[model samples]
Target: MSEYRVLVVEDSPTMRQLIVFALKRIRNLQIEEAGDGVGGLKKLSAHKFDLVVTDINMPIMDGLKLVSLIRNDPQYKDVPVVVITTEGAIEDRDRALALGANEYITKPIQTARILEVAKKMLGV
Candidate 1:
């Protein structure tokens, strides 16, 4: 079977590593990491990814814009984007959902939940 791919976008190296660790539980995944939304976009355009896990606040670009862009672009419109953020504000979650994020995960994360979401999103 071809390996499924997941793109992770976050400014913090530690958070990125943590997310990768959580998601690595899924076998045969080719995970890509981006420091921020701009970098994420570049990678997104360059590759076909099955899922995207991103943080909302970052330099250059933010998760909201990324989600909007993904939704606007026909090529990636249907891709599942999971927004992981430190903010637990209701507005933030609403905005991300409105922008087309499939899931919004707050910080202080439960790794297992992320894994579950990933499996459901990828139908793995």
Candidate 2:
């Protein structure tokens, strides 16, 4: 049985793979991947997840927009979102958090950091 479901939204295949690998270490997780925020939205609409991990910059849509949509939409409201991105600026972190991301980690990402945040966000 799955203990949790996590959606990883990243445009880069390599980055997405890395995030998936980290999430898999948590055990009992059903992980889903999306190429961008638009795809993330589609996945969210189709299924329920305990967490969302996204990258800040991407084509079609971005993490900020995803967070806003998730936070404002009643269907997705209260879901935890973690933004892992190369955009390490203070403003970028502030923006993502203000938009309702539960956690923000700038690249290059540490394996333990991602896993730690994921566990904390999921209450595991």
Candidate 3:
């Protein structure tokens, strides 16, 4: 069986580490990390990922624009993007959904919930 690839885009090194740690706990999980949306886009374009977890606020580019780009690209249109961000506002959630995020979760994340969502989405 192939490992499930996950792209994690966040600005904070600590948060990124936390996410990486949580995801590593799952078996057959392969992770790639990016510091911002630009890096995320670069990675996305370079490789195929089964799932993406991105932050809303980032330098150079934001998660919304990155996700919109992903949705707009015919090649990557069907890829599932999960927004894990600090922006808990209703409008932000609506915007993310509109931009093609399959799911949204607030920051200070619960690792178990993250795992559950990942498992449900990835069917692993």
Candidate 4:
């Protein structure tokens, strides 16, 4: 089976590493990391990803802008995006959903929940 590619866009090093480690549980998953939205966009243009896992707060660019860009791009519109944010506010969740994210996950994510959401969206 081909490895599923996942792009993780997070500013915090610890959070980024945590996400990478958590997703590694999925066999045949290839992970890519980006520090912020700009880096995320650059990575996106360089390669196709099966899923995008992003954090809401970051410097240079944020998850919302990145989600907007992905949705706006014709070529990348089909790519599934799962927003992992600290903002648990209903408005934030609604905004992310309205921005075209396939799923929204709050911070301090459990490994099982991450796996569930990933499998649910990617149909693994």
Q: How far off is residue 114 in model 3, in Å?
A: 1.4
* Tens-digit lDDT track of model 2 for 1-124: 9989999999999988888888889989999999999999999999999999999888999888999999999999989999976754778778999999989888888878999999999989
Assess every candidate by TM-score: 0.95, 0.96, 0.93, 0.94
Better of 2 and 4 by TM-score: 2
lDDT of 1 by residue, 1-124 (tens): 5489999999999989989999999999999999999999999989999999999988999888999999999999999999986665778778999888999788887898889889999999
Clashing pairs in 2: none
The parts of candidate 4 lying over 4 Å away from their true place are none
Query: Which regions of candidate 3 deviate over 4 angstroms?
Result: none
lDDT of each: 0.91, 0.91, 0.86, 0.89
Choose 1 or 3, whichever is better by lDDT: 1
**Predicted model with the maximum TM-score:** 2
lDDT of 3 by residue, 1-124 (tens): 5488999999999988888888888798889999999999889888889999888888899889988999999988888988876655667778999988999888778888777777777877
Q: Against the true structure, candidate 2 has what lDDT?
A: 0.91
Candidate 3 TM-score, true structure as reference: 0.93
lDDT per residue as tens, model 4, 1-124:
6479999999999988878888898888888999999999999999989999998887999889999999999989999999987755667767888999999888777878788898887788
